[model samples]
Target chain A: MTLEVADLQVHYRTLKGDVRALDGVSFSLADGEIVGLAGESGCGKTTLGKSLIRLDGRMRHVGGTAVLDGDELPIGDDKAMNARRWKEVSIIPQYSMSALNPTRKIGKMIAELLRARGKSYREFKDELVRRLELVGLTEKVLDNYPIELSGGMKQRVVMVLSTLLDPSLLIADEVTSALDVTNQRAVAETLVRFRDMGFVKSMIVVTHDLSLVYQIADTIMVMYAGRIVEKAPAETIIKSPKHPYTRALIGALPEVGLEYGDERLQSIPGKPPHLLNPPTGCRFRARCPLASEECEAEPPTVTVEAGHEVSCWKAN
Target chain B: MGRYFRRKLLIYGLTFVIAVSINFAVPRLMPGDPVARMLTRNSVANVESSEAMRGYFNELFGLDVPLWQQYFNYWGALFRGDLGVSVFAFPSPVATVVADALPYTLALLLPSILLSWFVGNALGAMAARNKLLDNGALPIGYVLTAVPYMWLAILLAWVGGIILGWFPVAGGYSFALTPAFTWTFIVDLVHHWFLPFLSLFVVALGGWAIGMRNLVIYELESDYSNYLQALGAPNRLVRRYAFRNAVLPQITGLALQLGVVVGGALVTEVVFAYPGLGSLLLNAISSQDFFLLQGILLFIVIGVLVFNFLADVVYVLVDPRTRLGLEGGQS
Candidate 1:
């Protein structure tokens, strides 16, 4: 395993109290593994990704242990985590268009960035240009300011910049959400190619779009509120979901061949529970159609098959 | 481009017409007469009577014509650079008085504006990066910004000049040296200008710091900032990227403030006893020097319009989103 996270519990501080954004989530990714973390908004998918890289002011890492390449990551301490950030674990954030500096030209900005990491631009200039070309951007773009590039071009530039150091694990949070359909496909394909080229050993693609994740993810982990409800191979999770929450979520999606007249899609009944003082036992019990009295107690994660896990009382 | 120029030209023309009309009308409508006040205060025994003062006013102001006609005549005179003679000052053209006062105001205001902006923005950026530093800096800025300009001027004079004895107490230049290009003279001039400069600097620095700090704080919370952070570009890179993009709105705001700065320097100048345009305007107002006041007001109106135009151009340059109607440009 290249990345292992155990009992991760992250929360957001508010005036009222703490909001349990990510509660007791555990998962692992092997070398070259691409895991798709899918959930609705406020389901802690983005929180999980941010916890691995850099947590902002409000986010508090309550309890978690993340092991990357035989070394424990001290994610709670900002100064201690700096040594591992760009070189070991990098992230491609959602809003990549505004990521570049407006005043500096693209080449100069990249050179400054590389120099800060104690690397010489002269040594990496040729490779950088070649990589830009691979992303379908011309070398001339290096001389132009960020204002000159289109949205898609800027997104690509950000992508290339993130993977420049070939980190062990890359956490991509909704990277394709802002792009057009054509650009989305291209950017997604570029991510796969980057993995194939050994630019990143493993990746966790966080998105609300399950179909897009289905296309790229080797494994799919469905989360509800803050807990991982289901985890399996991409095919098994899509074809036969054991958890009721995952089934309802997957059923809500609009498939290409499925007509609305033939079979109308149904969205999940209620919204995710508020993390601030959340309900005891199962967080999804309020909306789960299959909830039993046994679900009043916290459901333990069960492994019914090799390498597949589900958290529900009835998952036999 | 032609359309934009035409629109701007139309605005400029309208502004000039309105300003000139106000300049001509307000003095006529004012309660006191410049000629009467001048004669009453300084006239000899022969010029004591109201009839004699009326004759002086009529001859000096060309008051035989109708008010509108006199206004038109004044407008024509303005076009020809003949802002009529100041009634109080002996036979000097109003424009000459303004011209003499203009350079000093510009010299003091321009450098003060630039230095405040530079120092405030640099500190604001640094404060945005370091949270603990921001906690200390933000309140200090608020306190400084809250201080009135007059009070700040007095405080600077006392603390900077009296207690510390680091700078001179008053005046634009040292009387000990000639106003020529010599190192000793330049240093002395700078030393003299320091108090007035510091006064304006302290007053303006707070607004810039608070504005930039708030702007950076808001920017730091934006998704764009998160994107930069996630890229592993380091703290400085993230700050520069976020601040560069976020500071666009504030730039236009700062430009608008420049117009206010030119007009609002009165209190600072009075407290410092500095002979800038603000002090000159104050003197003209107290003496009811209508023609000089009109000239100064017209000059200020034109200066404000020019600065606003420059700000618009700068807005277009800093944010491409403005050109594309994505961010800075208003609907």
Candidate 2:
């Protein structure tokens, strides 16, 4: 395994109480494996990605252990975790448009960034230029300011910059969310190419768009509220999901070539439960169709297949 | 480029016409005969010879000419940089009085403006990085911003001058030191200027600090900052990147402030008795020195317009998103 996460529980501090954003998420990614984290908004997908690298002021790492390349990640302590970030684990944020500095020329910004990591730009300039070329950007772009580049170009520039150090794990947080379909496909393919080229060993692509993830991810994990309700191979998860929440969520998506009028798609009926003083038992119990007295107590994660996992009494 | 320049020229023309017209019309519409007011302090003494005073005022104030003709003459004289003679300061043109005061105001205003921006921005960046610093500094900054300039000026004068007796109370320089171009004289000038500059610095620094802090907070929450963080760029890199982007909006604001610095520091200058444009304008108004007031207002209006135009050009340079021709070319 290249990455292992065990019983990760992260919460956000609020005026009322602690909001459990990421509750007991456990998973492992094999070498070269690409996992797609599919969920609705506020489903702890982002929290999981953020926790793997750095936690912001509001996010408190209550309890969790993430092992990257058999080394324990010191995620909770920002200073301790600094050693692993960028060089080991990296992320391509959602909006790459405004990511670059507007004042400095692209080359100067990149040089300054490299120098910050204690590396001289002179040594890496060749490789950086080659990567830029691979991304279909010319050397002239380096001379131009960030505003000179188009949105898609900026996203690609950020992509190359993120993987410049060849991190062990890359967390691409909604990287394609802001792109047009064509640009999205291009960027997605570029990510796959990066993995194939050994720039990054394993990856987690977080998005609400299940179909897009279905096209890219080798395995898919579905999360509802703050917990991972289902995890399986991409084909298995898409064809036959065991968890009720996953089923409802998959059923909700309007797949390409499937018109709305052909078969009316239904959205999840109820909103995700508020995490502040969340219900005792299962967090999704309120919206689950299989809710029963047994669900009053939290259901343990059950492994029905060699690699597949589902946390539900019915799945067991 | 041509279109942009033409648009700017159009704006400048409109501003110049409106500002000059207002400057001309306002003085003419004032109730008291400025000539009579110039001649005698009491209105009763001038009232007995009001008709003769009106004729003298017509000749002296250019009211003898037809309104439209006078407007043209004023406009012509303005283009020629020949603002009419001051009523109170006999034989001296309004332009001469303003020119004499300009260097003093610029000297105080420029340094204070630069210092405020530099210190405030640095403090803002520091506050953004450390939550403890932000929490501690926020209230102090707010109090400073909210406190009126006049009040702060008085407080500083009382504390720094009267109580501590650490600095000079008033005036731009010492009477013992003769004015010269030598470094010694310059150093002495600066030493005396310390109190006035410090007073203005405190009053203005607060706004810059608060404005920058809020901007940085917004930048910190932005996707770019998070992206930079994910890139494992050090805290310093993240700060520089965030501050650079966040400070773009403030550049224009600072430039606007710079243009109006002459007119804007009225209260600060008045309280400190600084011989700057603000004090000059104050004296002009009290004496009903119409020409001087018109000249100063016109200078300020032109200064504001020019600075605002420079700010726009800067905006284009800083963020290419504002540049024309390329709209939504990005995906």
Best TM-score among the predictions, by candidate number = 2
Query: How does each model score on TM-score?
Result: 0.84, 0.88
Candidate 2 residue spans exceeding 4 A from truth: A133-135, A254-263, B1-6, B39-61, B131-138, B159-194, B323-331
**Span of ten consecutive residues with least summed lDDT in model 2 chain A:** A254-263
State the TM-score for model 1: 0.84
Model 2, TM vs. native: 0.88
Worst 10 residues of 2 chain B by lDDT: B322-331
**Candidate 2 lDDT (Cα, 0 to 1):** 0.84
Question: What DockQ does each listed candidate score?
Answer: 0.31, 0.50
State the displacement of the C-alpha of residue A173, model 2, in Å, after optimal TM-score superposition: 2.0
Over A1-316, each residue of candidate 1 has an lDDT whose tens digit, in order, gives 8999999999999999999999988899999999999999999999999999998989999998999998998878876787788789998887787777666778988898888677899998888888888899988988877777888998888888888888999988999999999998998889898899988999999998888888899999998889898999988889988999889988998878856896668888888899898898988899999998999999989997986899999899
Give the lDDT of residue B13 in candidate 2. 81
lDDT (Cα, tens digit) per residue for candidate 2, span B18-42: 9889988887776665676765643
**Residue-wise C-alpha lDDT for candidate 2, range A144-250, written one tens digit per residue:** 77877788999999999988889999999999999999999998889889999898999999998888888888999998878888899999899988998889988
State the lDDT at B191 in candidate 2. 70
Query: Residue A210 deviation, candidate 2, in Å?
Result: 2.5
lDDT digits (tens) for residues B189-211 of candidate 1: 67877789888887778788888
